[model samples]
Target: MSEVRLYSKADFSECRLTNHPLYSYIQVFFSQELSELVENSTNGTCYALEVGQKLCLVVVAQFQEGQTYPTSLRAQYLDYAQEELALTGIKGKRLLSGAFQLLKRIVPKTIDEVVYVGNYLLSTNLFQPFTTEELQKIEALLQRRFPTKTIVYRSQNSCLNQQLMENLSALNYQSFISRQVFIAHQSQVIQQKKTFKKDRKLAKDTTFNIRTNFDVTNYSERIIELYTQLYISKYSQINPRYTPAFIEAMKTVQNTSFTGVFDEENLIGVTMSWELDGTLTVPILGYDLSYPKESGIYRLLTYYTLLRVNDEQLFHMSSGVGPFKLSRGAEYFPEYIYYKRPASAKERRLSFWLLQKVNTILTRMSNKRAY
Candidate 1:
């Protein structure tokens, strides 16, 4: 059996290359810079198993050491830190998060502590193939590792929709966070829904032409401009992820990517995403609402994304944060979070307190009112 070996940096860089799926990891997200970053990374460890020398899964802690370093890393520094870390894979839900897991084996307070941590924004295909049953199995594994009344799984992008939430609830995972996802699924009766007829009168006024995967220069500023406009508008429940600067920096990212509806001379709306590693991630969307009735652009964008990308292993349209998705025909799936405990009681207590602080900081970070 080929062991899933943890290759060091020299090995990672020196390995002879081939036309492997792993090479996909090196593209936009896991650039040489990001790969090299793993060396001095205190927050996390990166691991990969050579799959026939062509495929190497992008694996690492979506986080760094904050007393949560893996047992391996902790053992190396145990005399000084007395920490433990363990790795896990995505049992269900988000791609990057569920793909693999990592944690400190030791906890504070009691041996009762448990941790099943998931991080959003990993490579799109990290969960290459996933299922709900496998997720339940992960929960079962945590049960054997650590017993607990509480588990926490956090998600961004608001991609998990209501039906999925119901399924999870049937399985005992409830929505404890404000984040949400939207879906638009087509069914037998609804399959015959009326066609969206373009108003010829408004068509003349609408000059926006939609395109895929273009350089940010043509529409970067304008896209961000619409985002800023949205920031001022009250429609968006939370528009706290991107700053104009971050949006600008994204352009430098390879596969400078997004789907946009441009109005002749102006950029009317754009749905910006990143092809990180091999996964597609939704960072944000900015649309000119001035043409809600006339634009019909968001609808068009969704249709094309489904028509083109849906066949290639189904794209994650994200959570039900927008009403538009429900009308368009997207299906929602449940995303979950699980937490298992450390063997040590002392570490469990420490983990609890640290988690409290971390959640607070994260919540505030997402709240633009304070920004």
Candidate 2:
């Protein structure tokens, strides 16, 4: 049996697991450079955990004691209440606002100190297999190190992470569907979805050029600007407020590929993606909201992504635009957040339990309405 060694930003460079199979993952995700970037952009503090020599996990500690909702987990998990209620008209808006206020008073306060295992601040989390004994050791170590903080493991549907989710469940972690993610099999989409065919045609006819040969370091600022325009300014400030430094840092990350959508000399769209186990996930994507909708830049970007997914690969499109994705033959599945609190932390545990029940009811209602 090997020991679980934890590394904080202060001593992360001292981690001696150089010969680990996933050493490249450590360089990209757990490096000091990326840790600084994440801490600067979000409310979480990043850490690394080495479980013997076989596994290395990215750990994020979110201490949102006095943080605003935009920078906290509350925004990611519960802010959808506002969007969902808007569909119900004025009365629903008012009622939901009041209910949200009540929840804000109770929910966010209880989740102040949380430790997220394997959180990369992305919509989807990928996992590597380890024995139940390894998981137990990791859990015990986290519990001992942060006794009062709740522990969370976030991952996609059971289809992708069944064994890991089951392991967490057996360890008494309560699971909740955080959001629904969309997945499209490339060959299926190309062959069966007419909308995909139309999108591909539109991409082919469009004047904008999708370039993968540009230097990421040189376009870092523009990438951040375009990303902020769509993800933060237009959508929600709750999205990670990534800076140019983060974009520039991508030059050192070997796994991720960045592509730019250009209209002649102007860059109008950007996407960052990585593939693992024949599954491609685009974690960073943004387009110029100011561009004319008729220009079909967004469509071109999506088409380009689909082209990357060959017959052997599946594309995980994260969450949002349910109807658009579904129309293009994408299947939907629930992404989950699994959590556990210390037995001595009664109040926090009770709060999370109540939250879990509420989330379960809401998810069921949403599913019923969707179908």
Candidate 3:
């Protein structure tokens, strides 16, 4: 029952939950590229408290620069807020809290680089614990220290910190995840083990194929195309998400392990994955929108997860609102989007102002863009 403190990244390996399956899950979810961004930008002053040998309390933060955003003159802000406000209080709270926490941590240091910060956590098997008030207190401590910076605390309907959103708002702080949707596995991923095994065989038997290795030759364009199709089918009606440059960057990350299923030479499905710190993450996957029967893409990808599951890692499927994954037996891992900061006055002043400006600009921005 001893709580081992992780005050530095060097202490990561020794921390108990670092060895857990779910720990690997969150690591994999952010992917190596995203993780490295956090890694390269992080200030090791970050800390965590490990409970027993399973659950961990992690705090990730970075100091960075200003971000460049394209101006949207034709964009309308009214309709956007109307819809955003139309969402239930539960959802609005989850998104804002998560984003706010990240902003709060990195605000003071982000004088030069546009950085996103907060706690990225891994809860040990069956022993996760953290309350909403605890998270807000962390945010308050940051605000007390740095009053001018614009910091946001963000999270979504996280079961672990259910009371967070209301508590933060009650304190007069605004929160948002902005443009994001979250989906979790409702059932267990193990039940689909049989189906996953069968799909791999099906992919191999016919021209319908799947690969364990990442061959980045003609693949970049393929990655771009399929991802674009996914955007068109899934998100185009509502919002324009994933720019061409962002899609192109997917092919450049290291330790990338991607699996693709083909329908007689046509790349029907592709899952862009990465393995790191013993975790595997699928941040992007796409298939023919019309191929409903082949939704087995997820099942096959889970089957592909067998490659690393035995290596003591949890396959992180990343964030999405998709519900189909719940039926596949992937366990739901609840986590909070905590708002915390370093103790300092210069930091506090800078943080408060930054949050206000960004929130104002974002609030004024429209949801839909022609470009």
Best-matching candidate per lDDT: 2
Residue 159 alpha-carbon offset, candidate 1, angstroms: 12
Put down candidate 3 lDDT per residue, 72-175, tens digits, no spaces. Answer: 10011112223333442433445554555556465544332111223332111112333445544445544544454333343333432345555655655445
Query: What is the alpha-carbon lDDT for the whole of candidate 2?
Result: 0.69
* Backbone steric clashes in candidate 3, count: 52
Every candidate's CA RMSD: 12.4, 3.2, 10.9
lDDT of all predictions: 0.40, 0.69, 0.43
| Per-prediction backbone clash count | 51, 0, 52
**Higher TM-score: candidate 2 or 3?**
2
- Candidate 2 versus truth, CA RMSD in Å, comes to 3.2
lDDT tens digits, residues 298-349, model 2? 7777888887667778788877777777787777777788788766665655
**TM-score of model 2 (CA atoms):** 0.87
Rank candidates, lDDT, best first. Answer: 2, 3, 1
Candidate 1 residue 266 Cα shift, in angstroms, is 2.2
Off by over 4 Å in 3: 1-115, 118-147, 151-207, 213-215, 236-252, 292-295, 321-323, 340-371
Per-residue lDDT of candidate 1, residues 1-371 (tens digit)? 22223344446664454444444344322344332322222333333434323233332333333322121122222211111111212122133221212223333223212242332222111232223554455456445533442333333223433343444456666442222233333333123344323222233455667677566765656776676575435333122323444455556555336777776656677776644333444555767777775456666655545443332223455543333554445544433332333333244455445444433433443342110
Better of 1 and 2 by TM-score: 2
Model 1 RMSD to the real structure?
12.4
TM-score per prediction, in order, is 0.49, 0.87, 0.45
